[model samples]
Target: MSAWQDDATRDLMGLGGRLALLVRGEGSAVWDADGNRYLDFLGGIAVNSLGHAHPTFVNAVSQQAAVLSHVSNYFATPQQLELAATLKRLAGTGEAGRVFFANSGTEANETAVKLARLHGNKVGKKGLVSLNHAFHGRSMGALSLTPKPLYQDAFRPLLPDVTYIDNTLEALDELDWSDVAAIFIEPIQGEAGVVEHPAGFLRRARELATENNALLIVDEVQTGMGRTGDWFAFQREGIVPDAMTLAKGIAGGFPLGALVTFGEASELFYPGTHNSTFGGNPLATAVGLAVVAEVENNDLLANVVTRGEQLRAAVTDLPLVTGTSGKGLLIGIHLDGPHAGAVREAAHRRGLIVNAPTDDIIRIAPAYTIGDAEVEEFTRLFAAALADVNGTASEENNA
Candidate 1:
C-alpha cells in the first residue's frame, strides 16, 4: 500500500481506502499526489458545483476571511443576510420565507427535523414520514427518517413515530396525513442510486400535505442548486414544499447548509429553538453567494441540462451500461450485471472518477459547468474503461 494510504487509514474513519491522494484540481479535472490527472466525474459527490478551485469561490472565501469570518450567530453579517434573501428569492418563498444556515447537508436535514418536531408540538400531529431507500443523513434525527437497516441497526432506539413509505402516490395515499407532522421527501434519491420519485409524486405529496396540514419538507441536499436541471428538484413538479433542506453544491464545495421555510412553516422556529456556532459564518455564506451568483450569471443550469444530455447520450450505449437514471448532472449509469464496483475501479484506473452507489448503479454527478471537451474526454475514458472490463463495443460507438 502507498504511504499516504497507510497514513489515511490510520487517521480517517472513511473513504474505504484512499483511492488517490488528490493534491490539486482545476476546472473538471484533479491531480493525485503522483501527478496522475483524472476527469472528475463525481465532483465530490456533486458538492463541487463550480468544479474544484473555482476563482469566484476562492475569491469569496479569501475576501470574507479577510473581512469577517464568524460572529457566533449573535450578530448577522452582510453575507448572512444577503444569502438568506438570495435563497428565498431563488426558492420563490416571497417575504414570509426564512433561512437557517448550518454546515452540511446532514445539519440542514437535522434542522428540518427540528422544524418537524416544532410543528408536532404546535399541533396534535407528531408523526414524521420519510421514503424507503432514502438517504437523508446519518445524524440521529435524519437517520431515523432513513429506514435502511445497515445504517439504522447500529443506532437503535432512534426517533419515534417515524414512518417509511415508497416514493409513489399509492404509498402517499395510504398514509394518514392528519397524524403526520411532516413528510420528508427527496425529488431524487441521489444516494439511493439516483432514484427519482414517480411522476406527479411530488405534486400529489403536496396536495396531501396541504389537505391535512402536514408539513412537506423537501430534501434537496443532493438534487438542488441546479443539479437536476432546475433550481430545486421540487420546482420541476411546480410545488413549493413547506420547508426545504439544501447543501452539497450550495457553497461550491464550502461547508454550508440551509433550511428554507415557506409561508406559515416559517413561524415554526422561535429564537431559542436552534443555533449553530459556525453555521452561516461569513466565510461560508460569502462563498455560497459567489457560487449562486456564478451559477445564475453564467446560466450554468442550462449547461447542466445540455451537458447531462450530452454525457448521458455518450455513455448509455456502452457495452456494460443497462440504462441511465436521474436528471441533469445527477445521473446513475445502470449496469448490465452487479458490476458497478468493477466498473468504478476500471474507470478510476483509466483516469476517470466515478462511484458505485449500489451493486448495479455507477453514479456520475459531474460539474455543472462541464463543457464539450470535458464531456468528450469523459466519454473516451469511460468507454475505454468499460471495454477494459467487458471487451465489448457498440456498433453505434461515438468515441
Candidate 2:
C-alpha cells in the first residue's frame, strides 16, 4: 500500500483502510502513486458525471472562486437562482415547485423527512414508508427512511416511524396510508445492488399516495442527473413525484444537494423551518450550472442510454454472470455464486475499479461521458476478472 493508504488506515474514522491511493485523474481513469492507471467504473458513486478534471468543472470552480464563493443563505446569488430554475425545469416542477439546497444527499433526504412531518402534522399522521434494504443516507432522519439493519442497528431507536416494504405492488398497498405522511422511493435503489422496482410500481405508488394524500417523495440522488438514461428515473415510469431529492452527479462531483417539492408540498417550509450554511452558495451552484449545461448541450442522456446498453451486452455472456440490473450508466452485474468479493479484488488487480454492494452483485456507475473505448476496455478487464475469480474462488476478497 502507498503512504496515504497507511495514513488512511491509521487516521480515518469508520473507513477500515483505503483502496488504492488515487493521486490524480483525467477522463474515466485515475493513477495511483506507483503510476498505475485504473479505469474508474465507480465514478465517485455516480458523482463524477463528467468524469475527473473536466474543463467545464475546473473552469466553473476557478471562475466562481476568483469572484465570490459563499454568503449566508440570507443572501441569494445569481448562480443559486439559475440553478433553482434549471432544476425546476428539468424536474418538471413548473411554477408551483420549490427548491431547498443542501451540501449532501443525506441532508436533502433529511429535508424530505421534515417535509413528510410538515404534511403529516395537520392530519395526525406520524408514519413513513420505505423499501427494504434502501440506503438513503447516514443522518438520523434520512437513516430512518433507510431500512437496513446494518446501517440502522447501532443507531437504533430511529425516528419517523418508518414501515419497510418490499419492491412489490402488494407490499405498497399494505402500507397504512391512513397514518402515512409519505412514501420514499429510490427509483432505482443504487445502493442496494442496483435493484430496480417492479414495472409500474412507481405509477401505482403515485396514485395511491395521491388517493391517501401522502407525499410521494422519490430519492433521485443516484438516479437523477441523467444517470438512468433520463433526467430522472421517475420520468421513465411517467409518474410525477410530489417531491424528489437530488445530489451525486448534480454538480459533477461537487458536494451539493437539493430537495425539490411540487404542488402543495412546495408550500410547507416558511422561514426558519430549515437552513444550511454552505447550501446553494455561489461556488457550488456555479459548478452545478456548468455541469448541467455540459450534460444538456452535449446530449449526455443519449450517450448514457447507448453506453449503458453497450456495457450490459458486453458483460452478460461472461462465465458465472447470472444477469444484470439497473439502467443507463448505473448497472449491477449479478453473479451465480457468492464470489463478488473475489471478482472485485481481481478487477482491482487488473486495474479496473468496481464496487460490490452485496455478496452477488457488482455495481458500476461510470461517468456519463464514457465512449466505446471505455465500454470495450471495461469488458476486457472485467471479463478477465470474472474468469480469474471463478477458477479460484477461495482467494482473500474485499472492496
Candidate 3:
C-alpha cells in the first residue's frame, strides 16, 4: 500500500480535494497502486523543471548534504553567495542588486511585500496596485495582493492598501499617484489560465510606475527559471521591474524561493529588518546553483523555446481547443467548452497527467527535458480526453 494514500486521505484536505491515488513518482511519470502510469505534463505545478529524480538534482542534494546543509542566518555559506551572485548575473548587476531567500513562492512574495512596504514608507508612499486575476501566493501578504473573491473571501480583512486594476494601460489614469507605492503584475498570469498582458502593456506599466514614482514588481514565481523560454518573462517584454519574486523552479523541486531587487530598492531592507533562519541554507542554495548551472549548460532555455513551439503548433488546430496562450513550456489551452476538469480526468485515465486552470482552460506545464515522444503522447491523450468529455465517442474504459 502507498503511504501517501492513507496519509493524504486522513489529513490533507487543506489543498484541492482528492482526485486520484498516487503511489509513487519518478521522472516525468507517476503511478498508483492499481498500476497505472501517467506521463506528467503538469510537472508538479511547474516546480519539477528538471523532472522527477533527475540525477543532477539528486546528486547535487546528496553531495551538499554530505558536505553541509543548514547554516543559520548568523553565518554565510559559499553556496548561498554563489546562488545570489548567479541570480544577480542573470538579472544584471551593477544596478545595486540583493536577494532574500525564502522557503516557498508565498514566502518569496511576502518578502517582496515587506521590502516594498519598508521602501514605500521610507519614501512616504502608501499602498500598492495589483492586477485582477493575479495570484501571488496563499500567504496573507501575497494573498492581499491577489484580487479574487473565492481565494480571498475565506480569509477576510487581509493586509490593507491594495488596489485591483485590470491589465489595461488606461486603468492607471485615475489612481492617486503618490499614494501608490508599487504595482504588482505577473508577466503571465499562471493561475488565471495563463492570460497574457496586452501588447506593450508592460512598457506602459513601467511608464506608469515611473511617472508615479512607484516601483514595479513582477511576480515570476510561475514564469521564471526558463519556464517561459527566458530567464524571466519580463525580460522578453524589455522591462525591468524594481523587484522580482521567484520560486517554483529555483531548486528543481526543492523548497527554495528568492526575492531579488535592483537599484536603490535593494538597500531598503537592512540586516536586522528582515531575515529567515533556514532561508539560505547551504543545501537548497547549493542545489539552486546546480539547477541554474544545468539549465544554462544544457541549453534548456533553447529546448523550452523549441518544445513550446512544437506543442503550440501541434495543438493549435484541435477542434476543442480554441487557442493557446503563454510562452515556452508554460502553456494554457483555452477550450471551447467548460469540460476541462472532465478532460483532465479523462487524460489521467489515459496515462497522461494534465490539469485544468478552470472549467474551460487546461494548463500544460511539462518539464523542459520532455522529449518529442512525451509531447505526442500528451496531444493524443488530450484529444481523446476532449473527445470523451464532449461525448463525441462512447465512454472508453481507461481512456
Which residue segments of model 2 deviate by more than 4 Å?
Answer: 394-399
TM-score of 2: 0.97
TM for candidate 3 is 0.95
Question: Candidate 1 or 3, higher TM-score?
Answer: 1
What does each candidate score in C-alpha RMSD? Answer: 3.2, 2.4, 2.8
Poorly placed runs, candidate 3 (over 4 Å): 1-7, 392-399
Per-candidate local distance difference test: 0.92, 0.93, 0.88
lDDT, candidate 2, equals: 0.93
Per candidate, the number of residue pairs that clash is 0, 0, 0
Model 3 agreement with the true structure over 152-178: per-residue lDDT tens digits: 999999988888988876776666677
Pairs of residues clashing in candidate 1: none
* C-alpha lDDT (0 to 100) for residue 27 of candidate 2: 100
TM-score of each: 0.96, 0.97, 0.95
Model 3, residue 169: what's the lDDT?
A: 68
Give the alpha carbon lDDT tens digit for every residue of 1-399 in model 2.
Answer: 657866776788863436777899999999998899999999998999999999999999999999999998889999999999999999899899999999999999999999999989967888999899898999999998888887889998889478999999998888778899899999999888999889889999999999998999999999998999999889999889989999999999899999999899999898888999999999999999999999999999999999999999998889989899999999999999888888999999999999899999999999999999999999999999998987676444431
